[model samples]
Target: MTAPAASPALRRPDGSALRVLVVDDEQMLTDLLSMALRMEGWEVRTADSGFDALTVTRDFDPDALVLDIMMPDLDGMAVLQRLR
Candidate 1:
């Protein structure tokens, strides 16, 4: 019997799964975002606040960041500014 075909996945240049960081004050939103990215075969991490996001970003160095603009600790714009 033939094996099932695998879904095409987004990989890094080193042939590793793409890493993604989802940052939002809303737990539910982050959960949904993480789920979607995980289904795409990505490495997903969630941060509940902008401060946490910064820490995760440094450690994870994700290929992409999904950030919410309305976080309590720090806003999306501030996070981007700090990251830069």
Candidate 2:
């Protein structure tokens, strides 16, 4: 049998592997997504609350972000707004 297809490659402008931040209130979901992204060879970080997300975003400055809209302590929308 042929080898399984590889995941699509991702890169940043500087030619480094892409970085991603996943924000959600659920620890399980965050852990799951972080594991998946890491398997794809992407840098991954996770935050369990919006407030923590904002702080991590500022420090991490990831290439992409996956956010949950409904969360305690400054929802996703507000986080996006503050970032903008």
Candidate 3:
């Protein structure tokens, strides 16, 4: 294989690295995504629950978020509603 194409790098207008928050109940998935995002030079943070996701979002103020559709404590839909 061609070493799996690397993900495209993303950056802000000022050439600063982007910040990303990944939220998922599955630890493995979260860890994997964190690694991939970090490879693109992004600042990555993860939360294992919807509540924790919200808390981290507030504190970190990330530029982007990757959330699972299903999760305990407060599903993704609920979290998205609350955030909006």
TM-score for all models, in order of appearance: 0.88, 0.87, 0.85
Ranking by TM-score: 1, 2, 3
The C-alpha stretches of model 2 lying farther than 4 A from their native spots are 1-8
Candidate 2 Cα RMSD (Å): 2.4
lDDT for each candidate structure: 0.92, 0.91, 0.92
50-72 per-residue lDDT for model 3 (tens digits): 99999999999889999898997
Model 2 per-residue lDDT at 59: 95
State candidate 1's TM-score. Answer: 0.88
What TM-score should be assigned to candidate 3? Answer: 0.85
RMSD of each: 3.3, 2.4, 3.9
Most accurate candidate by TM-score: 1
